[model samples]
Target: MTKKAQTPAVQNGNTDPNTLQLHKDPAQTDAAQIAAMALGSVAANAMTARTFAKGTFGTLDVTECVMTLKQRVDTTHDGNLKHAETTLTAQAAALDAIFNEMARRAALNMGEYLEATERYMRLALKAQGQCRATLETLAGIKNPPVIFAKQANIAHGPQQVNNDSFPSSTRIRAHARKRGTTPDELLEGPQHGSTNMDDRAATTPTRGHPAVETLEPIHWPRKPRRKSGGGA
Candidate 1:
């Protein structure tokens, strides 16, 4: 005969100890499942909260480092700008001083130039006066014979001449004809002749004049002349 089949021991129609029976009371099973699920959810939430806190702390550290670096950079930029401004101000002052000195020198030079011009003008006036006096003296001495003739004419014509009357060429010619001479021959005297000394002096060349110096020749050393026998 076959051995009799062993019957499995069952608790509420489930043989596994870990699994609840399907035939168990529904309300009690639901309550137990809900309690287990609530505990699992609470653990999951605690783990998620810890992870979020760690990520937030890391982000805060990064933000703090960025803010610190930005602050340092701002401080350095401000300091550089201040230094540049100071240097610019100093340069402006130095340029102003230089310009003022240039202006002062210009004014001094202008004053000296004006003083020299004034002195030159005074000397020129003095020389001009002396030249005029010398010309007047020469004229007086050289015109003595003409003065005597004019005086003789005035004395002879004292009754006929008015204050504004000038001797006409016809009257001068008649007087020269009565004297048995031509008008030109009577007028021509040694000192008061038609030959002007000023004109003669102007037309005559000066003696013992210095020769003009020629320009120096420009040539490189040891170079052959282009034209050997001609003046440059």
Candidate 2:
């Protein structure tokens, strides 16, 4: 007997071969069904492969772009930091130079001040020496005898003698005689006579002479006062 052709299921006006009925002898139709199933699986595998490839490529591109931007930003930030460091270093150096210069100037000024002070001290010492010398010279000139004799003559005019200048011991003897006292008694007391030779000469000559002797005390000049403040 001859068999009729089998029809497949229909959906949306199309027949689906996958849903077609098979004969009772399934082994004879197994090869054809397996081939169709393999073709459908290949189509699905290709679609999956395309999707994975597109996603992987897009992810890789985005990652590369982000890395590049990060690298640029990091480089820019590093450059800014380096510039700031350089500027700070320069400013520090400038400040150091300024301080060093100030110290140097201060040292120079100190040196000058010390030198001026030393010069002033030297001048003052020189002036003091000159003053002392002048005073000593004046003291030597002012004969103490002349002053004593002049004072004595003024007090006791014609009655005083004008003997040769005597030593202090002789003058004390004469003074003791005039006072009607012993030389030893006069010498022993606190009222001692002048020991200076000039004083002895002046007083002794006036005891019994008519000679008018003039005596002047030596006058030492005073040191001149400086008008400027401090010697320098």
Candidate 3:
């Protein structure tokens, strides 16, 4: 009989229990990979939360800046409108003084000039009255008021946006009709108008935004009356 060939107890890539030869179990390796993937998912969730929180803070910061700008505009317009009224009051008083002067001296030429000036003052007062009315309307708008906004969310909340917290051109118009004065003229700012006396025109004083109509100046002739007897 031929002798049977002996086979090795351990195959290649197999571990021997008594030696350092190592082998991996497929199921156990797969389980370890799954656990690693779960840990990575946890890290990714943490990163995502951080990113969202960062953007939320940025939005809050921007909202704060917008509110600050609105405050400045509010203060500026408040002071501006009040100052305009006061200045107009002074001008009206000055015109009255001129009328008193005209009454004291009886010259037809001076009377005519004074009448023209008074007409300009009346137009100014009318414009001022409109401004006052509009300002009252504007001031009536509540600031930071609780307003409802439609949104898809977990629960209903007050609107976060400030729709009219600051003045736009429309708001600055104070709801006054544009019929009397152009919106620009109604809101004549500190930056408007000429200081030079030479530039003064015999017309209704109008200083405003650049868009305001440039009215043609009326040349109210302060022409001298003719002499009873003689020559030119």
TM-score of each: 0.16, 0.16, 0.16
Q: For each candidate in turn, give its C-alpha RMSD to the true structure in angstroms.
A: 48.1, 47.9, 39.6
lDDT of 3 by residue, 1-232 (tens): 9854233232444232212211355667866755653465443353444345554442122223333444545666675455444545566556556555544443433447777666655555565555565445444442325779865435367643324555666554656554555554533444446554334455576767557677999999798987788655
User: lDDT ranking from best to worst?
Assistant: 1, 2, 3
- Residue 58's lDDT within candidate 1 is 27
**Cα miss at 40, model 1 (Å)?**
65
Can you list the residue pairs that collide in candidate 3? none
- Segments of candidate 3 deviating more than 4 angstroms: 1-80, 107-232
Model 2 Cα lDDT, one tens digit per residue, 97-183? 554554454455565687655555555455445545544544444432344334344444546445567456667777888997865
lDDT of 1 at 79: 56
Which is the leading candidate under lDDT?
A: 1
lDDT of 3 at 35: 63
